[model samples]
Target: MTYEIALNKAWDKIAALASSKKYTVKYFTDIYEVRISDRMMLSISSDTPASEDIAILVLHYLTGFLKYGYNPKEEWISFKDIKGGQSYYPAYQENTIKPILEKFKEKTDDLISYLTESLEGRIVKGGDVTVELPTFSDVYIRMVLWHGDDEFAPEVTILFDRELTEIIPSEDIAVLLFNLAKRISDEL
Candidate 1:
């Protein structure tokens, strides 16, 4: 379906459940707000409209959250490990991983600084530079980067909470990562 159709459908689903006791008690409001990145916020309400791509992603997340509830297992896994993630890996690599590698390959320290200072990410072990960036309340994305040598090319790896697919489908996950990489690589 087109993004507009999908967004409207998703919004309708969320609106249908807005008055439920479970929604009010757990969420505390019919209007829901989600952080798309440090620079953007997606509000799920009739009066607040967002770009179609962003609206679809936020609505899908809200729908999933209200239906399944949040229960992150804290275990991190690669994109390929997510259900149907393999099918989207090529695009994810090109759109999400390649840009980040190109942007930070020669400036690893700057990348580290940006993550910690601007994105509020925390340094973690594993790669030359690894950071756990919180994208939402209790939801995070782990980014691991290895600077290139004469013989090897720079590489970046992104990991998500094991339970992330419970809240975001595989396709939207690609979009989410692409948006994140764009934000990170964009001139700041």
Candidate 2:
């Protein structure tokens, strides 16, 4: 029976490790992934609630997968292809995609200034454009800002096409990104 348990032991182990993301909540199933997002949604805006584990599990396993070890680049294979995968986000040539592509390029440069690293994510000069990033975490942020006023809801989109950019935007994700930048900067 998959149920919730206080993630003391798991978190304890995580604390011993040098990682910032601690698995404090326990899942009684084989969680393939864990997401930190709004735990609940109310019909109205006044339904304010805290974020909680929106975990994706595999089967019966005590601990969920550790994303730290999961290379963000790997999940981006099909998203990088721009033409494959079971389902897809249409990149019609006629839409505002052209302008969005241009803006995305500008944003990539901005990220380069801070990240000091090269990634698969890039903005094509012309043609059908879609946001593809090293991690599934980055796709939404890329789209939201690029979409701007035309943006839909300006919130996270779980595009099942692939984990093109899952820029978690969580404390742990922030810490990881900063550390990654730091590590890259140190190399320079």
Candidate closest to the true structure, highest lDDT: 1
Q: In the order shown, what is each candidate's alpha-carbon RMSD? A: 5.9, 14.4
In Å, residue 68's CA in model 2 sits off its true spot by 13
- How does each model score on TM-score? 0.80, 0.23
Q: How accurate locally, in lDDT, is each candidate?
A: 0.72, 0.29
Model 2 segments more than 4 A misplaced: 1-76, 80-86, 91-100, 105-108, 114-188
- Candidate 2's C-alpha lDDT? 0.29
Model 1 off-target regions past 4 Å? 20-49
Q: Report the error of model 1 at residue 119, Å.
A: 1.7
User: Candidate 1: lDDT of 188?
Assistant: 37
